[model samples]
Target: MNALNPVFYKEKIFSAAWFRTYGLLVIGSFVLAMGYTFFMTPYKIVPGGIYGIATILHYKLGFPIGMAALCFNLPLSLWGVKVLGKQFGLKTFICFILVAFFADGVPFLLEKCGHPHPYDPFQLQDEVLLASIFGGVVIGIGVGLILKTRSSSGGTDVFTSILSKLTRKPIGMLQMIVDSSIVLCGLLVFQDWKIPFYSWLTIFLMGKVIDIVMQGYSSDKTFFIVTDKIEEIRQYILVELHRGGSIMPVRGMFNRTEKEMIMTVVSRREMVTLQRAIYKIDPQAFTTILNAQEILGLGFKRLEE
Candidate 1:
């Protein structure tokens, strides 16, 4: 698709959204680099990703983490390109290259510019917990930005994909297993049980932060109401909440009575009002509310362009 339609992809890559996405990617890359160069690596906190392997290699075999990471990521990045798609390949390549340079170059740049890598944090706030939390949040935002754009920098992302394909497992489940394994490896390799705990904390927080960054914190509750007083409920929703929804026919399994199910999506705050209104109208209303990560339409944000 990218090869046959360069103009579309080219213009898309240079569009405002593309600019924002890549800008976020750059900032995220720097943050990820800092988490490794300053926080995780310095403290030997291997919280997965390519840097996780790089950390063990750096300490055990005296490997240059930057080059090691580049070496480690090359094949996975290519694999992402081969299997995922060209756009993903391009973005992943860009992100990986930027991170490779930043992770190695940031400290040198800072030292050259006058402020050397501060040792105060290393000495004073050297707690594994601190490293885990801060590093996770930073890395989460970084990875979230890359993923929000539907791009990746390979590493375990590719590993997870491969495992999922081979094992017929969900990508998320496989990713979790792989990340957990990295933490466990840290525990075994370093012989510190705390490493696994802290690493797991990082992984958990990182996943949550990634969810929040990409999905946003604003949550919605979608309700499917099976009630006899459809008009009353529908009217209240339309007039009170200024929202519209669909009504469909459904039969009560136990009673075998025909009924209408009102399906509506509303923000969390609106849930209370909706429920109360429904209750006032039909006290015996059978309502089921489910969490909505996103609701894009008339009342919510428009679909991405």
Candidate 2:
């Protein structure tokens, strides 16, 4: 939708809800980057992209990490704007600047506390595997929130998007390949393959978490129950589950006996309850539950009404 579109101009975009979402993304990105600088970088666990290079520089040359990340990402982000499109580029630029600024500020705040802990307890510990999992979760939350706002924390993701467009390969596979190369570099320089391996783990988990957040994690199922107790089945489905269904008359394919066919859609949790209700009402109910790729109606979220 255009910026001027009614939907785009909805009050929600400027409402308290929008501010909350933006605040979460900013804080989450800052905390995750702090985790890297204080714990992951001190121990030399490079994950990849601008953040990976920032960790390396922080460990080797004592460069300011937020500055390093911002500098490194600037050129790539500019390239993204030139190549990707205006909207994507602008959003990413804003997100990157915010992350860089906050990441740089976090360490100074921690030092002021005189905790001597040196690391963010809100983040993963010094352990490589835990760092990968927790760092990925934190960053994924940041990225996912930005995405919900039509923004991105510019990094290798932009490069991957460009590469996927040119190569006609799946974005996931292309990202894996590009990120794996960075991990290889870390391994080659440090001579510790475990670091690179854990970095890859972080990349994998981030992909999964971002996908779940962007698309939602709800799984749905469609059931087709063939039974003689059509009335009981309908009552259980409509009343107990509060779901709508359709019943039709049919003849058995083999026995040529008349039968009633019931079709319904439900979430995963509701599917179990429905099945149990069917079994209770009619033990011999022949039911077939199929994975529904798409459903559109009152109970489900649909692209079109």
Best by TM-score: 1
| Candidate 2 per-residue C-alpha lDDT over 1-305 given as tens digits, one digit per residue, 9 for 90 to 100 | 54576355233766786677667657656655654665456556677777887777766787877889888789887877788776555456767887777677766777787756544544444466776777777666666667766667778888898887788889888877777777777787778868877887777777787777677665788899999899988988888788898888889989899988999889998988988898999999998988775566566777531
What TM-score number comes out for model 2? 0.77
Worst 10 residues of 1 by lDDT: 116-125
| Per-model TM-score versus the true fold | 0.85, 0.77
Candidate 1: stretches off by over 4 Å: 1-13, 79-88, 116-124, 163-174
lDDT of each: 0.80, 0.74
The Cα RMSD of model 2 versus the native structure comes to 4.6
Error of 2 at 128 (Å): 2.9
The count of backbone overlaps in candidate 2 is 0
Check candidate 2 and list the clashing pairs: none
